[model samples]
Target: MSHVSVSADQAGQRVDNFLLARFRGLPRSRVYRLLRRGEVRVNGGRIGPEHRLQAGDRVRLPPVDLPPPRPPQQAPTRQLDELGACILYEDERLLVLDKPAGLACHGGSGIRYGAIEALRQLRPNQPFLELVHRLDRDTSGCLLIAKRRSTLRALHEQLRTGAVKKRYLALLTGQFAGRRQRVDAPLARYERGGERLVRVDAAGKPAATVFHARERYPQATLVEAELLSGRTHQIRVHAAHLGCPLAGDAKYGDPQAEARLGDIGLRRLFLHAAELEIAPLDGVGARHFSAPLPSALESVLIRLRQQTLTPSPP
Candidate 1:
């Protein structure tokens, strides 16, 4: 039997997930089997896989077969250089980066390495680093990394209580009628044809989004979106529900609109994480950060301006 005590860095995570991380080569099914068989115990009692671990809790594990350890994949030098350049800010307790689009926050599902992996390689001396939250792979913007366990916990609390504010910029097809609009809809995740998708459903979790029109083009409109309740694909689904799906959003977007926008240089999902605001975990005053739109997206806007004469609503 092996005994381990959960630390602040490991707290607040599901027991099963913790086990999977600890035993890298263990299959997920085998992990669940251990839980089902009561081979894994917490504080002298068997607990379900979904149980959230607490700091200093004792976990007991029974001996099990181990798989051959796979060699860690190293991040390429070019990728490391690119990630290093994307750094927006760094401090003792925080590391913020202007994450580029097409980069996943973490690696999995056949993806060899993502932003986190690259960072781990770039700063191997940093012993503790973890993602505070996740953005879609194609959503570029300010991403937060906590340098300390306490800082991570503090930020997670802020997220739970709705203290952290995240705003995004996106280009949507069709002209919006109002300067500002709000959508209150419930969102649910479902798998369709082996792909995950979110939709507005009455039985789903409550979600809300507020959108402010920023610019108007003949074929598309740029808008700023504030998330009231963070749900999977909340902004995208809400925007689509409003008859203004995100331009180039291959999943929930309009195909014809994307094709038209592609002719003007909108090649990727037209969503960017524009701003983030939150109080420091160290009880300091709030800090605000913003990431400007990438040049590719800007070029698309410039093209629209030159080709379309539509005037925006003042």
Candidate 2:
């Protein structure tokens, strides 16, 4: 029973995000339910959840039950401070952080207090905050945040045009040949027993990743991967297809290598978003950000190197 007008600042946002942002305590499932039933309309016409809003458009919001917001449900101040300390670079238009592993990029999908939620809580005064792109929850490293919708759109355009680049470092189970190798395979996402997974399928969308072997061990190889075309699980799936699944990747991994690495220190997914490069947007100059490998991962490599140096039993 309420109507809202989309302003210039609100343009380019998905209707779902706009609704969730406006209704703090709104249940995501409830929002989707309303959207599916056409209860939520824009410009007097029904639209799906992914529909983007435009300036000067009128949206009709039907009445719905919403729980009162709770302070306990919010992220703790200590965690927020820790996330703040991870900031690698911040400008009027963009913010970059060294996102740690196990912390998701955003909330929902059974996740609570993700990076975006924590940032919004920490900087309550900031009007605009949106993810420029998303990294897997198990993957750690450089993440981008756009402070304005205009900046978000510009960066998205750049991504579509291949102007934005990201470098990922992954530890594969088997020896990877060649100094640099490119995997050009399509990928498709499917669900099995309620768990979502991706695989290389001939009928899927085109995907590509270029990998540079950085270091090699008797049983493993460290490689830097440059994403040529962004796709879900492109690096992991491609690495597996190359006969060297990533170490510690339970979903798509080599079990024997996992057992071997367990002796050293491969306890988690060995993928890291090491670098990100954004080409100049409008008048803004190009920018680059990097994050060193986490110390735990560093220790794994150090131990592996030592193992390789030791003479085999005679």
Which residue runs of candidate 2 sit more than 4 Å off their true CA positions? 22-38, 46-50, 67-78, 310-314
Per-residue lDDT of candidate 2, residues 238-287 (tens digit): 99999989989999998888998888877889999999999997697888
Per-candidate RMSD, Å: 2.1, 3.5
Provide the lDDT at 234 for model 1. 91
**lDDT (CA) for every model shown?**
0.90, 0.89
Cα deviation at 197, candidate 1, in Å, is 1.5
Top of the candidates by TM-score? 1
lDDT of 1 at 309: 71
Looking at model 2, report the run of 10 residues with the lowest lDDT sum. Answer: 305-314
> What lDDT, from 0 to 1, does candidate 1 have?
0.90
Local error of candidate 1 at residue 59 (angstroms): 1.6
Candidate 2 clash pair list: 1-63
